[model samples]
Target: MKKLVLQFIYGVVVKAFLRIIVGVKFDNGKFLLNEKQFIIIANHNSHLDTMTIMASLPRQLIHKVRPVAAADHFGKTKFKEKLSNYFVNTLLIQRKRDKENPANDPIHKMVDALDKGFSLILFPEGTRGEPEVQQPLKPGVALVLLQRPEVKYVPAYMKGMGKAMPKEDSLIVPFNCQLVYGTPQIISHADVTPILEKMQHDFNALQEKLR
Candidate 1:
């Protein structure tokens, strides 16, 4: 019953909010494949990025996405934790800087989530940064891909989210934004550098497509 309610809120309420506030447009187009499971990586720009991406998806797909969020930021307060639980399927993980050589890597939690057959929404850039600013892809995403080599990888890019709600601001400014999904790719190489570079390139290309 709780899952059903949250799905309604996300697939309907949040979708409406995004349409009203940001004029969010999604161009899944040829990229929406038949694959049910994937590891989606996107460029992080603002708090709205994750919501925008999820809301942009078809309702069925939206419900299947489990966003990997930072625990320290989103789980700081009970209210925030409840809100996240009610709205999205979020897997909260600790920041790398918060613990050194911890017994359990947070990535393991992501692995568990994938093992259950849910698609992931990850920001390989790690944290929000200036829109269109180049940030190196973290190795954690690559490691996950290594572990789950059979999972499809999709690159999504958002444009205008930083301006809509800049990282420094709490108030949202009405702006038009686009979520572009690129073709799905399978990881064949053991080394992740080339794969990361290709994803970064695809993200940049998506950003350019919006301009």
Candidate 2:
């Protein structure tokens, strides 16, 4: 029943809003259909970033793809938590660590999701910064990759999402947005530094290509 609702939301509602209302154009979208579990990392700009990525995916995979979101923001209130969980099917993690409970870390939660065979949509920037500006990615993504060495990583860059729905605004404007997917690659490195560097490089290349 939950899967049916998610399919309806992503396949019909979100798809229509992104494709018709917002005019989203997807490049290399075929990569999103890969059968293997992987992580799709992208720049964070607006709330629409998650919805846009979700809508771009194939309807059958809606239940298999989970977006990693901040617990404080998306799961702060009971109503918001239910909406994000039941509607979006998000995997909410704490952005701030609890000093007493080491097990409550975000990286552990993310890796657990991957182990469960769900492809993740991650915003490495942690939070949405200024509109249209790329911020330095947090090392949490690199940490996750370190644990799941075999999982493929796909780079994605989104444009015009900020203008369509800026970080400060709740009302979405009808503007054309673009989402570009880069080739998926497995970064084999003993250290997180090299993994993070390669991830940033891939994201930069995708952003340049989008322009």
Best-performing candidate as measured by lDDT: 2
Tell how far residue 177 is off in model 1, in angstroms: 1.1
On residues 1-211, what C-alpha lDDT tens digit does candidate 1 reach at each position? Answer: 6557656776688778877766787675334448868988999989998887777666666666789998888889988987786677787888663235443467777777888877888999899999667588888788888888888888888888888889899888888777888888888678889878777788888878878
RMSD of 1: 2.5
Estimate the TM-score of every prediction: 0.89, 0.94
Q: Name the runs in model 1 displaced over 4 angstroms.
A: 29-33, 97-103
Candidate 2 per-residue lDDT, tens place, 1-211, comes to 9999999998789988888888888664555676487899999999999998888888878889899998888899999999999999999999875547657888888888998889899998889978768888788888888888898888888999999998899988888789988888888787878888888999889889877
> After superposing candidate 2, which stretches have Cα over 4 Å from the reference?
98-103
**Residue pairs in collision within model 2:** none
Q: Report every candidate's CA lDDT.
A: 0.79, 0.86
lDDT of 2 at 103: 70
Native-to-model Cα distance after best TM-score fit, residue 82 in candidate 2, in Å:
1.6
The alpha-carbon lDDT assigned to residue 203 of candidate 1 equals: 83
List the RMSD of every prediction in angstroms: 2.5, 1.6
